[model samples]
Target: MIQLITLDMAGTTVTDHHEVEACFAMAAQKSGLTVSDDRILAMQGLHKYFVFQTLWEEILGTTTHPEWQMRVDNSYRVFTEVLENHYLTHDITPTEGCLELFEYLHIHQIKIALTTGFYRKVCNIILEKLGWLEGLDDTHVGTASTTIQASITSDEVEKGRPHPFMIQKAMNLLHISDPQQVINVGDTPSDIQSGFAANCRLSVALSNGTHAADLLTPHNPSLLLGSLHELIPVLEDLRTRS
Candidate 1:
């Protein structure tokens, strides 16, 4: 039986209407980086700082270049400013069926943990806006009455998506040892890759988020969902089989 469910923020749980990509583009423009939208989208679910570092390295052909660190820092700073401001000033809402899914998990005695590419500050901002941080402490770990059992950010770990650090951190925080007892769900290829890297029982993808089904398919998610509500039957089926 699945004991924990790890969900990605932004496109997976929170409503994302390309605002992240827009922020990345704005930052790139300000930092004089010539990046395309597809490139930015491709980096979704990665640590924002790592994204900038990789982008700068790709453009300069080498990280040893003198201007690499400066470019990466400047672009990352701008991106963080833009992203944090966007979340602070704009309306933030849960994706469709998100609350319902949460309720289902709660009723079923399953633990819910959120994993995000966002840093802690921005992640807390979004969670606060949705009232999802009510009972969580400064570390963002919640109790039985709280909406979620844990919240893990990319900054909290040594590496982000496509690596399993964040997920492993969540498992550690929740005292879950076997990855086979966890189900990971997200809307990006990096998210799928990370879940599989963690050796999760299921690495599921949602097509209605940052990337389309065609784009996420190559990552080989165990299951692809069109909406959050679809997860209910899948979980039920898994429980039965297990």
Candidate 2:
């Protein structure tokens, strides 16, 4: 029986299209850099630093620099501010039926854990601004903080998605040791790949993110849901069988 559902944020919990493009545009303009939309789209489902590292390498032909880091930091700071001030502030909307599905899972006593590639500060800021952390009396929803400056050490078993570290870490914190008891849900190929690598019993993919249906279909998720609202019936079926 499934005991927990681990959700990925960004393209999963929150809509990412207009907000992301706006942020990228601000960052590129502020930094006097030009990143193509194709490049940004290609780097979806990756950590911000990883995306920055790639863009920095492409634009500067080198990935590391104190000055460049500051520039990137400043640009992203402005970008986040813009997201809060404009994108989400004026038009923050949850994915279709996400709240309903979340409530359904909680009512059924299923534990929920949220993980994301975003660093702690950014995640907190967005969650706060978008009201993602508000009015929740539920204890089942757990989110793991991805320490922004933590150096990667040898003991780290995973890096990021397409690595399972984030979700695995969330489950470990939830005290759910058996991966088979957890359903990993997300909205991209990397999400599917990460859940697959984590050995989740059910890997659910949604077409609401970087990957389109054509790109995600071949990976063969345990289920592909068009809307989060659809999970209620799926979970009900799972419960009946159990």
Against the reference, the lDDT scores of all candidates come to 0.93, 0.68
Whole-structure CA lDDT of model 1: 0.93
- lDDT by residue (tens digit), candidate 2, 1-242: 88778777777776666466657677777767678877666666667556665676677666566567766666666665665556435545567777787777666767766667665555555566656655432332433331111111112335777788877776665678999988888887778888999899889998866567777899898898887778789889989999
Per-residue C-alpha lDDT of model 1 across residues 23-86, encoded as one tens digit per residue? 9999999999999999999999999999999999999999999999999999999999999999
| Candidate 1: Cα lDDT at 226 | 96
What residue runs in model 2 are displaced by over 4 Å at the alpha carbon? 64-78, 129-158
Error of 2 at 50 (Å): 1.4
Say which candidate scores most in lDDT.
1
| Each prediction's number of clashing residue pairs | 0, 0
RMSD values, in order shown: 0.8, 5.6
